[model samples]
Target: MSHVTARVSEGERDRAVELVQQAYADGLLAPAELERRLERALTAVSAHELEPVVADLPDQVVHIASTGGRVTRTGDWHVPRRLRIDSEYGRVRLDLSRAHVPYSRIDIELRLAYGGGTIILPAGASANADGMRTEWGKVICKAPGRQSPGRLHVQVTGELPYGRLTIRRK
Candidate 1:
């Protein structure tokens, strides 16, 4: 989805600062990166847009995993494994393990929806198909130089459906 922009509130800004500070203290981000994200948060237009940018900060990080049975559901839900991270300049990984569907080709889908950012895959890592199947939905793992720090889009598709997506620091 496209990013939604608007004016940010005091509470939102405060939360942003708190998150950034925590990231810095944890040594997840460098001094410069912390300053950059702080500036963005201070002058953010809207909470919605700020959230993604802040979430993608250099120190802020994330890790998500999904397997068989119900993973993400509404109300009275229980996550066998769930982790949401935020750092200054870090890595976000998604480990997906899907069971095979016998003779039929299982369709494994991966989606990365954010306002704008870069999607870095594992080093020397290459997708089963092209770097990224644009028309098909999966995000193209653009070169680091071409990485957009805003509104990154990713989607992974698999037929065998037995693999995991992991995110970690170098």
Candidate 2:
């Protein structure tokens, strides 16, 4: 019999170990398989796994600095992963595209004004915001989501009725 010490709470650890024993007694797992599964379960139940899950999530509605990670929403109309700012000849356009990020969860903030605009996102794979105004156009953005354990695609676009257009992502 080997002893395993995991940083999980006592009850959780005991429960996982019990499950392993049950698996073994049922002949569903070999000794080595039981040990491996126990270790994996203990890690899965550890508190440390919860920290980075929210580390890159934004806490407010306004963006200050860029977090430079990435965000993947499982749905649509999401806040963008990159803050986009465009200024030319006194006209500006802000595009917020947080769609198609790779992570399971994220938080971000963005605002567009002086013709600027902001988007509150839910989750999706892409985004676009464009409008026509007389004097000024604005574009605002939020921090990116974390790219820790997956791949994400982000595409941003800015176009004018008679001037220029840009497409970008990192």
Candidate 3:
């Protein structure tokens, strides 16, 4: 039987472009290849079309959403280039001490509504919470310095409304 191809969403296209750009930035792709992949990703209409654009990229984008309850990611999980977390009346935790971070940088987007969470990273990793915002909530970022060469750099972005976000190094 012939498999049906799923249509590509705008987010997927954008993610593909981001991956291509990241690969180019990381020196994994040549300028011409980056241009070609970006053009393909931008004009992709189906998942099949977009797959090849990011197939050679080493990083991925993961999205986790919770309506209510607790969600946690720990242990030796593969850390994607971009991670988006959404919680509504739920608690979320990400422990990245043992995570496999292939890239030197990662971006995390958080959307917490009436919920709180904590992020535990390795001591060698450095965190940037400049893009994060809070309203009627508290965000405690205790990221230490002295980043090693080629260490992971995490950029935390997004909003927390009436919820707490704590980033600590272990």
Specify the highest-TM-score model's number: 3
The superposed Cα distance between candidate 2 and the true structure at residue 59, in angstroms, equals 38
- Writing each residue's lDDT as its tens digit, candidate 2 over 34-146 gives 67666665666554642332233232322332233222123334443333443322322233343443333322222212222233433332323333232343333232433
Ranking by TM-score: 3, 1, 2
lDDT (10s digit) by residue, model 3, range 28-133: 9999998888889989889988998888687755998889988898999988888999899999899999888777767899999999989998868988887888
Name the lDDT of candidate 3. Answer: 0.85
Give the true-structure RMSD of model 2: 16.2
Write the number of the candidate with greater lDDT, choosing between 2 and 3: 3
Q: How are the candidates ranked when ordered by lDDT, highest leading?
A: 3, 1, 2
TM-score against truth, every candidate: 0.31, 0.22, 0.67
Report how far off residue 116 is in candidate 3 (Å). 0.8
Tell me the spans in candidate 1 whose CA falls farther than 4 Å from its real position.
1-4, 56-170
Which runs of model 2 end up more than 4 angstroms from their true locations? 1-7, 42-170
